[model samples]
Target: MSILVISPHMDDETLGAGGTILKYTDAGEKVYWLNISNTKEEYGYSEELCRKREKRYYEVIRRLHITDAVDFKLQPAHLEKYDTGEIINKIGNIVDRIKPEIIITTSPGDVHSDHKTVFSWAKAFSKSFRNPWLKKFLLMEIVSETDFALPMGSFIPNYFVDISDFLEDKIEALKIYEGEMGEHPFPRSVKNIKALAVNRGTIAGTKYAEAFMLLRCIEK
Candidate 1:
């Protein structure tokens, strides 16, 4: 089956479901990525820095063995500035073209505004009646964003994918997002990434795993 992962930012797909993605690709499934936001100058990022980040984005995708990727090129962290309908239409257009059987996107409860916005858009565009080609919709959890959400909005994953074999590949892919990682105790740190995997794996009865909230699924 074909799969599509919608990310609010460059590194979120890696942070949230990199291992599962690796597993899918390894199995010869076509996996695509849709990055909805991009670095912008107004965000205190220089043109050179933005270019650097873009370069790494491609490298990360290559390392993950993704079949294809599309960047919406929207300004990062400023998704709220655009009209909701516009965002939905843009995402809908991509979904129409891709016709994926499964879609993985940001959780609605994520603390980041960009993530929240993208989740809403994904939900609207992937509605069962609206997109019959979509059989499953999975919500992934970003390390810092999902973990920091308010108690009432916490990410409670119900679906777990054992990623024991691909855990190291996930970490290696995350390393491509050089600017996002930090020392231990930081959510994006390599240590914490491994810790999260181990924690999820314990819950999943595996050596390592990735957890996702099943938003919707239709059995044929």
Candidate 2:
């Protein structure tokens, strides 16, 4: 079955679900990527810088062998006005068009306003589905914020897809976002990926991994 992955920024998918994507691809599932916020934001970037981030995003996808995709309309970061009407309609159209069995999105536990908006919009869109028979819905994590935030006593992971083979692919995909990594929030390099995965693995009892907040599982 085909799967749809929605990302707020360009590299987010890789930063979050690169391993998961690789696992699915290896299992012979087609992946459709929807990147919704490749925009020029003067508030946090110069025009050139914004373009660089967008280009880096493109590089990451290509490196992952994700050739068929759509980088849609520019949704503003943080203050992105959720056009529930438009987004709901558009997402329904996509669902109708692609008919994915699964949807993967950026997690809501994220502090990034743009990431949060992306998930919320995705939820609104998923509502319009003509087929609630959709098999799976999951929110993937980027930046490892959720792992840190979940208390040591009460953390719960609903699904675990081992990424041992594709770990390097995840790193290669992440290297595309050079500008943001060295600046703020994160170092944005392949190095941190190992550390992040290691930490997540420590919690989940694996060597390295990517975690997803599993949302829904429809009966097949």
Candidate 3:
């Protein structure tokens, strides 16, 4: 099977589904790692910092032996102009090219601006295209460091996948976002991910699992 994972930023795919990607790869399936934004930003970097961090992100990915990784090289914040239709078309192009059996992406209530935008665009692209290979669209949470990530007022989970077997890999992947995280004080960061895994595992009949809000499924 072929799969496409849409990440808002470089580390998102890993933070959200690195273990699942590992699972798929172990099962001998092709997986595409696509990030919608560029790694550089003039505002956040002092020329050298950007260069250094960019190099490290790739180094980490390569070190992890990730097979397919695409930055898309889009502007840092996704749109200089902020046109939703343009976002849709761009994502549709990727979907058309990948024609994946499974599509994984960020969630709508994620609170992160880029995360929300990616969710909107992925939903639009999925509906706009009629790819028969597209059977499942899964939403994985990233940077669930806020109250919005919890079982909030309206957010509900549709399913969860056990990642206990790959929790160590998830921590390693989150480390790839080195510059941004920079020694987070909140133990809840990785702690929450693991905790969620255990909690979800109980519900899903596994030792540890990741939660997802499934958007589309063609059949059971």
Candidate 4:
């Protein structure tokens, strides 16, 4: 089965569903990453940082053993600036081409506008009538964005994946995004990541795990 992970930004994938992604790839399942936005200099990011981040992104793909990846090249944190129909069409094209049975994306409750926009696009293509190939649709929690989101939406997870064996792999992939992680107290810190995993694992009866909200599921 093919799986498509929609990331609003580069590191969101790692921070949100890295371990679960590793598990799928390790099991010989095809996983594709849909990178929704770009890190551009005009977005107040330095050109040097952009180049460095791009290099890291490729390294991440290598580490994750993803089947392939597609980049939307849209402006970061400014997805709202684009025409909604245009952006959705771009993502829809990818969905049609990939025809993935499973789709994972950032929670709609994320505080970041870009993440919220990406969630909308993901939801649009996830309807059962729109994509009969789709069997599962999940919303992953990006530490910083999900935790900091307003109470308009809650992320009470009913799905959990035991990522005990792949926890270290997730950490290693996250290490590549040095600029994204920070010391203790930062939501994306290595410590916090592990803490969340352990907590979820306890709930899942494992040593470490990743939690997700199973938004949609079809037995077929």
lDDT (tens digit, per residue) of candidate 2 on 118-176: 77778754442556647888888676444444444222567766787889878766667
Which pairs of residues collide in candidate 4?
A: none
| Model 4 agreement with the true structure over 163-199: per-residue lDDT tens digits | 9999999999999988788999988898999999999
1-220: candidate 1 lDDT, tens digit per residue: 8899999999999999999999999999999999988877877789999899889888988999999999988888788899988777777787888889999999878888888888888887567788888888899978999999998888999999999999999999988888689998988998999999999999999999999999788987
For all candidates in order, the CA lDDT equals: 0.90, 0.72, 0.71, 0.91
The positional error of residue 64 in candidate 1, measured at the CA in angstroms, is 0.6
Which candidate, 1 or 4, would have the higher TM-score against the true structure? 4
| lDDT, model 4, position 32 | 98
Task: List per-candidate RMSD values in Å.
Answer: 1.3, 3.5, 3.0, 1.2
Deviation of model 1 at 158, angstroms: 0.4
Question: Which candidate has the top score in lDDT?
Answer: 4
RMSD of 2: 3.5
What TM-score does model 3 achieve against the real structure? 0.83
True-structure lDDT of candidate 4: 0.91
State the weakest 10-residue window (summed lDDT) of model 1.
Answer: 124-133
Residue 4 of model 1, lDDT score: 93
From the highest TM-score down, the ranking of the candidates is: 4, 1, 3, 2
Q: Roughly what TM-score does model 4 have, to 2 decimal places?
A: 0.96
Model 3: weakest 10-residue lDDT segment is 145-154
Model 3 residue pairs with clashes: 161-209, 161-210, 162-209, 163-209
